[model samples]
Target: MAWWKLHKRDKPGGPAAGGAVLASAAIITRDQVRSVVGRRQEWQAQGWDFYRTVPELKSGIRWAANGLSRARLYVGRIDPDGSSAPVPVDAQGGDMSPAMVANLLAPLEDLAGGQLGQSEMLRRLSVHLDIPGESYLVGFDDPASGERRWLVCSPSEVTSTGSGGTIRVQLPDSQSARIELSIDDCTLIRLWRPDDEYGYLPDSPLQGLQDPLRELQGLTAHVLATVDSRLKGAGIGLMSDDVTPASPQQSDGPNPIHSDPVTASLIDAASASLKNRDSAAALVPLLLRVPGSVEDKFKWFDFAAQLDEHLLPLRESATKRLAIGLDTPPEALTGMADVNHWTGWLVSDTGITMHIEPKLGLICDALTTQYFRAAWEALGIPDPENWACWYDTSDLKQRPNRAPEAAEAHARGAISDAAYLRELGFSSEDMPDEEEQRRRLLIQLATTNAQLAPAALEALGVQLPDVGQAIATDAVRAPVEISRAEPAIEAPPRNEPPALPIAASAVLDDGWRMACLDLAARRALARAGNWLLSRSGRSRRGELGHVPVHEVHMHVSPDQADLAQMLDGAYRDFHAATPGETDLHAAVDLYVRRLLLTGIAHERGLLAGHLAAAGCDRAAA
Candidate 1:
C-alpha cells in the first residue's frame, strides 16, 4: 500500500475518512524531489568554490589537511582487550617492522599508478571530505602484479545506482566515460548525516557556514575596494564656495585666477598628476594652489580613517565565525600576531586534536574496513578481520617535554620503569625486558665493586689477592674471607687541651650564628623558587591549581639537613657566649624549623602569584 493510503486508513472515521483523506493528501512529485536534490548539489558546488576562492576558509582546510598528512600510517592487529598491537609476520611471534609493513602495502603508496603518494592522497582526501562532506576511494587489483591499487575519486563523479550495491564511477578515459562498479570496490567517507527525505547522503560542514562564508567574502571584497580607493588617492575630496565658474569677463574678485582659463587648466592638470604616482615619484611632493582668498575658499577631507573604522571590525568578526564553524583556531587561519610561543603551540595542538583527528579517524576507518581488509583477504593473509590499518599522530601533537618530572617520579618510586620510559617517548618494544634489566643491574653492581675493591682493601690494611686466583674461587666465599680478614692498624691520638664551657670562655657575638642561618635560609629559598618555576612551566594554564604543594615541600626537605649542619657549626663557635646550661642543639633545631616554615610560605606566595598571572582562579570558577 502507498504510504499516503496507510496514513488515511488510520484516521478515526474508517473507510469514508480514509477515502477523503487520500483524496486530500498532497503528493510530492518526482520533479520536486529532484529539485531539492539539485539545490543541495548546487550548494555543495558553492562550498567547493568557497574552499578554492576564500582565503580564510581555504587556509583552514589546508591547515587541517596538512596536519593529517603528517601522520604515519601502519597496519596492526586488534587485540582482544580493544588495544591495537603490531602484526606478527612469522610463526616465531616476531612482529613485522614498520619497513616490512610499508613494503607489504607499497601498492597503496601510489594510487591509480599515479604520482599520488600516501601523503598527497591523504591531503586530498581530507580536503574533499571537509569541503564537500564526502570522498570516494575505489580499489582494484593491478593486472600486471596482482597487487591492490586504489584511486581517489571525486564525490561528484561517483553515484549510487540504487541497485544491488552498484555505483556509477566516471573514469578519465579517452572518451571521459562512466563505468559501473560494485559498492564493495569503493569506499564512501562522509561527515554529517541527512535528516530530510532526499537520501542518506551526508551534508558538508559548510551547510551551516554558508551565511558566515558569504559575509566574509563580501567583507573581503569591500576591504579590497577600500584599499584600491586609497591607493588611487580617492580619500582626498575638494570643496569650493562657487556654484558655477566665472568667465574671463567677470574676473574682478580677489581670486581672479579662478576666472582665468589657463589657470583653471593648470589646476586641473596638477590635480590629475597628484592622483596616481609612480614608484620613482612616490616620495616627491607635488603642490597644487589657486590664486584666491585663503582658508575657507578651499577645503579637503580624508575618508580613509572613516572607512577603516566601519569595515575592518566586520571583516575580523566574519573571519572568526568562519574559523569557528570549521572547528579551527583563528590563529591557524589568520597570522599569529599578539600570540606567544606557548599560545602558538597551544593553537597548533588544539587544531590537530579537535579539528584534524576526527577527519583522520573517519578516513582511516573507512580505508581499513573497505580497502585494507579486502587487500589482506586477496593476499590470503590468515584471519584478515583481526588486522586493520591505523595512523600514528605522534608527529602532529606538540607534546611538552616532561622528562624532569618523569625522572623525579621514577626516583620517588611513584611510577614504574616502563611508565617512565614511555613518558620519555620510548615505545614498549624499545624498553628492555625484566630479565635484561636485572642482568644490566647485576653488571653495574659488579663493576662498581671491582673499582672500589682496591681502595677498600688498602684502607683495611688487607693484602690484595691475585686476580686469577680470586676469579677461580667461589664468588661468595672470596667476599666472605676478605671481609673476615679486614683489619686496619690505627694511629695513636695526640693529646690536646679540653674545650672551655660557654660561661667560662670569652663572650662570642650572635652575628656569626645569624649570618650562617641567613645563608642557609637563602639557599633553601632559591631551591624552592626554582622548583616552583619548573612545576609552573610544566603545567598548563588551567592546571596551575593542581600542582602538589606538598610535593614541592618534600623536594626542599633535603635543604633542612644543610641548614641544621650550618646551625650546629655556628652553635659550636658561639656556645661560650650563652649560659652554661643552655641547650644549644635544641635551640638550633627550633631556628631551622622556623626558617623552613618561612621558606615554604614564601614559595606558596610565589605560586599564588603564578596562579593569578595564569588566570587559574577565573578558570576554576
Candidate 2:
C-alpha cells in the first residue's frame, strides 16, 4: 500500500552492436504504439467487449468513474492556466443564480434514456473509455426554457466521418434518420491512447492489457481444475499389468473380495457403516484383498503442483500489468494490500493526487470550453468568455481525522465560530440569530450598569433611597463627605404671634425622637412630590402600600392635640410657601440620612416599641 513503483522501462542510452547510436520512435509514434492494442486483428462478433473480457479493467474504470461522477460541479471561471473560481449564472432569464446550471448538471429528473444526471453521465463516459477509448457529450439549448441541456451519447451510436471532422449519431428513435454533428458541437473526452485522425477512436485500455488478461484467465482455469480434481476424486487411478475378465463362478478355496460376491457384500456393508456412523463406534477396519497370482496397486495421481507453483507470482504480475495499462494503483484493482491504517490512507491520498485530479482536470476543461461558457452567455451574463465549469472533489477525497485539532483552533481563535461548526459537521443555522444575540447583550449591559448605579449617581451629586441602615450599608455606602446647602427661602410670615423658645434643660429624651420623626416625615413627602413631578406620565408604585410618613399626625384632628395641629400647620404653610424647594436630589439626601438615623435608634431598643404604637412605624412611613 505504500504505492511502490514495480517496474521501470529501459531508457534509450546505449549504442548498438554496430557502433551506431540508434534512436527508437516506437513509444512516440501513434501507429507503432497503437498496434499494441491489436484490436484491428482481433475477431469481432464474438460478443466479447473489452471491459467484460477483463475483470481488473472493469473494476479500475468503475472506481475512477464513480469518483468523478460524485464530484460537485458548479458554474465558475477558470484561468487559461487551469485554475478555477466560482461565478454566478442566471437561470430562465432570472437574476444570476446557480439553480438553472446546477439542475442541468445534476437533475432531479433523468435527462434522456435514464442517463442524464452527473453521476450517470460520468459513468457512461467511463464505460466508453474502458470499452471503446472515447466518450462524447451532446448539448442543445432548450428554446422553451432558455436553458442549456446535455446528454451522454453512447460511443457505439456515434461513427466518425472520414476526413470530414464530423460524426454521425444514430438517433434513439429509429424513425429518425442519422444526424451528423460537428466536433465543435459536442464535447469529446478520451484517454491518451494513440489513434488515427479521421476516426480519433483510441483503442480500449483492455487492448493494451491483453497479456495480463490472458495470463490471469489461464491461472483462473488452473485454480478451477485443482479444485475440481480435489473435490471429485478425478486424480485417483488403478495400476494393473493385465486386464482380467469377470467370472460368474466363485473360486473353490479362497477368493479376493472383488471376485467373491459374499465377501464383496460384507465389505460394502462395513464401509457403509463406517461412513454413516463414527468409525470408532462402528468398530470397522478398511481392508483390501488381492489374488496371490497377480499384483495390483492404487495410486493418487497428483498432477504436479504447477498451479500452486505459478499462481502467486503470475497473479501479481498480471495485476501489476493491468494497473500499469490503466494508470491505476494495483491495490485498487486487486485489494490485496498489506498496509496499516496510516499507510493505506497515504496510498489513498496519493491516488487522489496522482490519478483522480489529472483525469478530472482534463474532463472538466473540455466541458467548460465547449458547453459552460456558451450557456452562461445565453443566460445574459456579461463577459461570459472568462467563465468555466468546476467540480468540487472534496467529497471524493478522504478527510483527515482532525476533530480535536479543529476544536483547538476554535479555542485559539484561529477559526471563526461558523468555520469551527462546519469542521465539526454542524450547521451554523443552529446558532442564535443576530437580533437575538444583540438583545442578550443589551440585557447584560443593563444589569451590570444597574448594579453600579449608586456610585454613578453619587458622582453626580445625587443619592439613593435608604431602606434601613443595615440594608443601606449592604446595598451601597454613602460618600464620607458631602456638600450641603441650607434652605434658601424662608417661610411666609403668619398672622399669629410666635411661640417662645424652651430652655435646653427643659427638653425631654423623647423630644429628640419626635424631631427626627418630624424631619423624616417632611423629607419623605418632598421626595414623593418630586418623584411625581419628574415621572408624571409613568405609573406610580401603588401596590407598595403608598402610606405617607406623617399619616398619623395629619390624621389627628386639630381639636385633639393643639401641638400636633400647630406643627402640621406650620410645615404645610412652609411647603406651600416655597414649592421650588422640593428638589428630588435634595429630598433623596435628606431621606437617606433620616432613615439611617431611625434604623440605628431602633437597633438600640429605644424607638421601635413606641414608634409603632405612636403610629410612626417604618413600614407605614
Candidate 3:
C-alpha cells in the first residue's frame, strides 16, 4: 500500500487515522465554559438596557460613533524597515496601483447584499463595540449568488463555542437556525482583558460602570417624582370654625353640616373640576365663602418651595461621572457651554486619541486579518502580509488656523513648499510645480521692487521691465539683469518753479485738499517707517536717497481707477519738477508723489524739516 493510503486507513481496534488527536484530556471544564458565556450574556443585557434608557450614556456613544463613521477607509502598506508610518497602497513608489486597491476595497461598498453601506456598517460596529465591549463581523460566500456577503452581528445574536475558535450566530428567520462560523468566516473585536486566560472572552467597557449608570437613573427618577408632587400638591388653605348647614330642600339624601364633611366634599369638587380644565386653570383665582372669619382665614402654601435645590447639581455630577467612566469628554455628554472654539477642538482631539482611535485600531486589525488578507491572496496578489486595511481620521480632526506660521516657515526656508501647504490643511496635490512656483515668485518680487524708489533699485542692483504692462498681462517673460553702478549726487535746480500750494489750490475745495494732504502725509509716514526698518548693511550706502516715491502710483494702479480719478481731480495744477516730465498730469502726479516721499523722509528724521517749509520758502522767493 502507498504511504498516503496507510496514513488515511483506520488501524484495527484503534482510533481512526483522520480524527483529531490530543495529547491529554481537556483541562478546562464544561462548567467553566458555561460560566464565561453566562457572564458575557449578562454584561450584554445590562449594556443594552443602559444604552436604551440612559440619555447621558447614549449621547456619549452617539458622539463617538457618529464621529468615527465619518472617517474614510483605505488600504496602507506597512514599511519594511519601520522607519516611518504606513503609506497608502496607491501612493507614489508603492507596488499597488489605484485600480488594484479599488478592486480590493470594492466589497466594502456593497456589504450585506447592498442593505448596508460602509458608513452604516461602521456605525453599527462602533455602537456594538462601545456597548458590549465586543463586536462581530461575519463574512461568507453566498451559496446561491456565489458572492461574498458581510453581516454585522449583535452581541446577543452571537455565542462563542470556546473550544476551536468557532462561534454560532442565530439567524432571525422562521427556523432560527444556528450557523457555525470558524475563525476564517468571522472577526471578533474586543476590549483587552487581563484575566482572560484563553483569550476567547473579553471584558466590556460597561462592566465597571454599573454604579454610575444606576446613580444617574436614580437621580432622574427622583427629579421626576419631586416635580410630580409639586404639580399635584395643594396651593392654598382655608381655616374657619364656622360651618354652613345644608337645608332639607337642597339635600336630596342625607346631608352633613360639620366642617370636616363639608371641607372634604368641597376639596373633591375643586380637584375634579381642575383636572377636567386645561393647564390655564392653574392661573385662575379661587374664591371661598367663610362667614365671620377675619383673622387667619386665607393662607397660601408654597408647595414648589419644597423641591430640592441641589437636584440639578446632583444630576450634572452623575452625568459627568458617566462620561468619565466611558472615557469620553464631559462636554460631549452634557453641553458645550464651557468650551470655546479652540478648547472644543482640543476636546475632540483628546476624545479621538484616548477613546475612538484605539477602538478603531482594534477593529481594523481584526478586519485585516480575517477578511482583507484572505481576499487579497485569493486575487493572486503577492506578499499579502505587507498590506492591511486602515482608517483615515483626518476628516474628524478640525484644522486650526496656521497661515501665519506656515508663511513664516516658508519664508525662512525651514520647510519645503509641500510641508508648508500641509500645515495650512492643504494636500500635496494642491501644491504647484517647481517651475510654476518660480514664475510666481519672480512676478511678485518684480512687482514689489517696482514700488521702491529709483535710488533704492539702483542700490540693490535690481531692474524692472514695464511693471504696469506685466501686471496687466499677468505674465513676466523678460529676464531680470543686474550690474554694479557708481552712485552719483545730483544737485536740485535753483530756478525750478515752486510747487502749487495744494492747501490753497482752486482746483479742489478746502475739504478735498485737506483730506488729500492728510492722506498723503499718513501714507508717507507709514512707508518711511517700514523702509527705514528694512535697511540692511548692504543697502545702507544709499539709505538717504532710497526714500519710497511711488505712493500715488499705488493708488492709480489698474485696480484703483476710482482713486486715480479722485487724485487727478484733487491735484490738477500741482507742479513738482521732475527730470524729463512734460505732461501736466504727469507733473501734478510727480509733484504729489515727491511731497509724500519728502514727508515720509522728514518724519523719519532723515530730512531737516517738513516739505511745507521748503515750498513756503520757494513761494516767498
Candidate 4:
C-alpha cells in the first residue's frame, strides 16, 4: 500500500526554515512563492493537473510524542465517507495480526492486568460507569476522593455511525461480543451503561449524552482479535468479515488528501478569501505553492462549503434546512455545476448571514409548440435552437450569456443562420451548408460523449472515400460442454520472466519505519500497565526513530512517573493556564524539552537518535 508523511517544523518559524517564514511573510526578493508557481510547470511535466482542495481526516488521529520538547498535533487517517468494512477475523476466529488485536482490546487489558475497578476502568476509558444506584462519570472522577468527575473521550474515537451506537466488550475468557448501545437521543450522545440493570433505562440521563473521547468508543475495536483468538481456540463460527483495510485515494506530491465533505469544504471555501487574514495563518504553506484558476474558484466555493462545515454544524436548525434542500430547488445554488464555477452569485450578506444564488439555477419550464420555430425539423433541417420559450425557470432566464458556442446552438434552425457567422470564423449562417452542420455535429457529439475517439469520416454521414479497420484481431474458441474434460494443463519446464529490483530499495533503511516504531513505543508508554496494548515485542518493535516511552519507564519505580507530566508541569507554570483552554505557547515549550530529553536518550544509547529528527516521540505523545 502507498502512504505519505510530512516533517513539520517543531514550531512555525524555526532556523532550518532558511527564513521560510520571513520569505513567506511578504512577497520578497527571493522568489519563494514565485518558485512554487514556476514549479507548477515542472509538476505538470510529471503528471496531469486537477483543481483540488485539501481533504479531511477520515479517522480522528491521536498523535503523541515525547522528548526534551512538547508534542504537536496534525491530521492523519484516510476518508471514512462510509464505514464499508469490518475488523477481520481468521479461521478458528483469531486474527493473524496479534498486535492489532491486542491494541484494540485495551479496555479488556486494563480490566485484566491493571487491576482497576470496573467502574473506575470504565471511567478511565471515559466510558459510562455504573455500580448499582450510585453513579460516576468517566475521567471526571477525583483520584483522591473517588468522586464522579467529567470525562472526555480520546481524539481517536468514532462518535457516530449508521447502525445506531456500537459497543463491543471482552470478558476474562478473551471472547469479544458486539453489542448495540441503546440510542435514546442521537442528537446528544449515547453510551452503554456499565451496569446492565440500568442499561435499558431511557431516563437514566446519560442515555444520549455520549462523551466524545470515551474509551468505550474503541471498546468494540479492542477485543476484535481476542474475540477471534477465543473463537478460534474454541471452534466458533468461521470469519474475516470485519477486517479489511480501506482503499487508498488520490495524492499530490508528499501530501495525500482524502475526498470527503470536510476536504471539499476547506479547499472549495478557499476561494471566498484565498488571502483572508485568518486563513493565512494555516494556509500560507499550501497556497504559496499552488496557483492558477483553481485558487480563484476556491474562493467562491469556500463560502458555501464553510456554511456547511463550521457554521452549520453548531446550529442544529441548519442541518434540517440542508437535508431538505440537498436534493431539490435550493440545492442548485450549492450544487456542483454552480458552486464549482463562477456561474453562481452571493446575492445577500447581512454582514452576518450570506445567501448564494445560482445563475442558471434550476429547470422548471414546461415545453410546448410555441417554444419552437416553424419547420423546426425539415429532415436535414438545422437542430432547433431558442428553447427559451419552453422553460419558465428564473435560473435559466437569468443565466449569464457567455460561451458563444452554447449560445450559437440557441437559435439555429431549419434555415442555417450562416449569415450571422462571418465574423465568428464561420461562413454565413442560414446557408444550406452541409460541411458546417457536420462539423458542428462533431463538436456536439464529442461534448456529449467525452469517451470514444472522434468518429472516423466514413462513420459520419459525411462519408470518407476509403478506409479500413484500424487494427487486426483474431477469433477465440468458445462453447464447451461442462461434462467435457478440462483443457490439458502444461507446466513451464525452464524459462521464466526476469526478476526486477524495486526502483527504490533503501526505504526500510530510511527513518520512516523508525519514526512509526517510535510513535508506537510512545503510545505503549502512555498506556503502560493499561490493558489494551499487548506485552512488549522483539527488538523489531523498538527499532529506529523510536524514542520508546519504555526508556522513561525504566527510570520510574512501581508508580507510573511520566516525564511528559514533569515537562508539562514545568511549561504549565512558565505559561499561564486557563481552567480549560489548550495553551498554545505551553505546547511549544513542552515539545522543546521533550526533544532535549529524547536527544539525551539517544546519546546514552537508551533510545534511537535518528527518530528524533522525525519527531516520532512528539507525534505519539
Model 3 agreement with the true structure over 55-112: per-residue lDDT tens digits: 8888888887887788767777887897855677556465657667665555344344
Compose the digit string of candidate 2's lDDT tens values, residues 1-621.
100010011223424433332121111222322222223325221114545665766788887787767765555544567544454343224544565455334321223223236767766666655555655565433345645445565545656654344556665558465666554333333333335553444655566666677787777778877654333212223344443323234446665456565445444544454455434313422223333332436434432233487678988888888887775666787675477765676777777777666666666666665444434433334675666566566666555667899999989999988777766766556778987786566554333442343454454445544543223333223322211222111112333322212321133234554455445445544443343333333343242226343322222112211222122222444345434433322233333333322221111122222233222343213
Q: What TM-score does prediction 2 earn?
A: 0.48
**C-alpha lDDT of all candidate models, in order:** 0.52, 0.46, 0.53, 0.26
Clashing pairs in 1: none
Please report the candidate that would top TM-score against the real structure. Answer: 3
Q: Each candidate's TM vs. the true structure?
A: 0.51, 0.48, 0.58, 0.12
Worst 10 residues of 2 by lDDT: 1-10
Model 3 TM-score is: 0.58
Candidate 3 residue 516 C-alpha distance from true site, Å: 22
Between prediction 1 and prediction 3, which has the larger lDDT?
Answer: 3
Model 4, range 1-621, lDDT digits (tens) per residue? Answer: 100001111224457764432111111122221221112122221111110110000010000001001111111121245242222222114422564333323222222123224323222221111101111112212335644222222211212233333222122233342122222210111232223565433121122212211222233233453343322211111123332223234568675554663443344334323344344323322121123354343331111111124333433343233323221233322334435334443311110021111100110011112111111221111332321111111211223334375346646542234423432434333455788777777766533321221362334654322211121000000111111133111112224321212311222233553454444334434443221113334452344224345344322222112333333233333233322222222223233333333221212112233223223233222
* Candidate 4, position 228, lDDT: 33
**1 against 4, candidate with superior TM-score:** 1
Winner by lDDT between candidate 3 and candidate 2 = 3
